[model samples]
Target chain A: TQLLEQSPQFLSIQEGENLTVYCNSSSVFSSLQWYRQEPGEGPVLLVTVVTGGEVKKLKRLTFQFGDARKDSSLHITAAQPGDTGLYLCAGRANPGGSQGNLIFGKGTKLSVKP
Target chain B: DAGVTQSPTHLIKTRGQQVTLRCSPKSGHDTVSWYQQALGQGPQFIFQYYEEEERQRGNFPDRFSGHQFPNYSSELNVNALLLGDSALYLCASSFTGTGYGYTFGSGTRLTVV
Candidate 1:
């Protein structure tokens, strides 16, 4: 089975602090997506990285895809209370692969206190 | 336009009972996918439907099955429920053949007693 390992299962930081969450896998992916989920709600797409070594920024959140397409990271700078949520990273298997689903990591729960 | 919609926001069932969850895809979407999410875990894909056919499925067993309608809506049915089946069932919709357009519903919280 294709697995994505996410680190720092839980994180709590004061406002203005910065934090980073990492997702790694041994298998290559055709694309990697980052999502943020609030309590009692489904995950909302944050960004998608399709090319290796690619980086995309959304306000204070920065996402990067590894050069090998087997890893990705989400970095939040000057975090605020609104940034607190469960962050997830999911990878789509390479086309025609046995795994056709979007394999996800357990996720990183972030709490930014003001 | 309205986003993906799921019915029966919450459900409680006993073991061995069968349950069905429904989903209506977002406007302009023709594909629907189902996922299971345990507490504190990311969603795991159960299957995907397009063109009123099962296009792909994950590692779930035959006890979990689904169907798609001509209008692109879908239904997920689970038989012989177990305690392990308790979780949030999520439905996502997107245009077929796209990798990034998935929009998920709020999810139905299922509890198997």
Candidate 2:
């Protein structure tokens, strides 16, 4: 079974601080997706990275896929209180093995206090 | 367009009882997948349905079963549930060949007593 390991299980920071969360794995994936989930709601997709060494930025958040596709990271710049939530990383295996199933990381819970 | 939708929003059931959860895929989506998320844990894949058939399943037990309809909606049925079965059950929908992200529903919170 494939497993994704995420770091910094919990994080707390003041507003305007920067934080980075990491997700690592031994298995390579066809693509990796990042999601942010608020309390009492399902996860919402933030971004998807499909290539090695790929970097995608959305406003204050920057996401990077490892060169080997076995790891990824999410960095939030000038974090605000609204950025507080649980961040999850999910990996889709290469096709033909098990299609449409996403292996997920335990996730990092971030709390940004004003 | 509306994203994935799941009902009922919350349920309470006794141990050993059977429960069925339903999901309607997003517009233009043809695949539906189920997941279980325990408090403070990531969601675990339960299974995926396509073309009214279960195409893939996770390591869950036989007590966990599902069915898909022609309209791409799906139902997850759990029999003889245990307290451990209590969790947030999420439904996600995606197109068959789209490598994009899957759209997730708000999820049904199942509490097994």
Candidate 3:
């Protein structure tokens, strides 16, 4: 079975700290998506990276897809309290809906203390 | 436009019972997908519907079923619920057949006792 393993399941730091969350997989993906979920809410998409070795930035968050398209990462620069949330990385499987559903990582829960 | 919306923001049910959760896709959406997310975990795909037909499904059992109406709204039904089923049930909507992105609903929180 295909799986995405995320690292640093839990992270807590002061408001000004920076951090990076990693999502790795042994299988290639057609696309990779990053999402953030707050308590009691569904995950909201933050970005989608389809090309290998691609990087996209949204405000202070930098997202990168590995050169092999088998992994991805999210880097938060100068994190703020608002950046505290559960960060998730999901990989889209080709032929995708059935034999390959979006494989989701367990997620990284971040807590930024103000 | 209104984003995706789910009904019964919260529900409490007992094992062996049945429960139904509703979801309405965002405006202009044509496909719906269901997911289950346990505490502190990412959402797991349950099934997806397009053109009012089930086009795809996940690793869940038959007890977990769903339906998509002609209007693109959908419902997730679970029979003989188990405690492990307790989790946030999220519904996402998107344009199908083109591999577009999805917009998710707030989710129905189901706590199986």
Tens-digit lDDT track of model 3 for B1-113: 89999998999999999999999999988888899999888889999888888888999999999999999999999999999999999999987555546788999999998
Rank ordering of all candidates by DockQ, starting from the highest: 2, 1, 3
Q: Sort every candidate by TM-score, greatest first.
A: 2, 1, 3
lDDT of 2 by residue, A1-114 (tens): 899999899999999999999999999998999999998899999999988999999999999999999999999999999999999999999653225799999999999999
* Winning candidate number (DockQ): 2
Better of 1 and 2 by TM-score: 2
Estimate the TM-score for candidate 2: 0.97
Which residues of candidate 2, in runs, are more than 4 Å off? A96-98
Clashes of each: 0, 0, 0
Give the lDDT of residue B43 in candidate 3.
88
Candidate 1 wrong stretches, greater than 4 Å: A95-100
Candidate 2 residue-wise lDDT, B1-113, digit = tens: 89999999999999999999999999999989999999989999999999999998999999999999999999999999999999999999988875668889999999999
Per-residue lDDT tens digits for candidate 3, residues A1-114, read: 889999999999999888999999999998999999999888898998888999999999999999999999999999999998999999998844322356789999999999
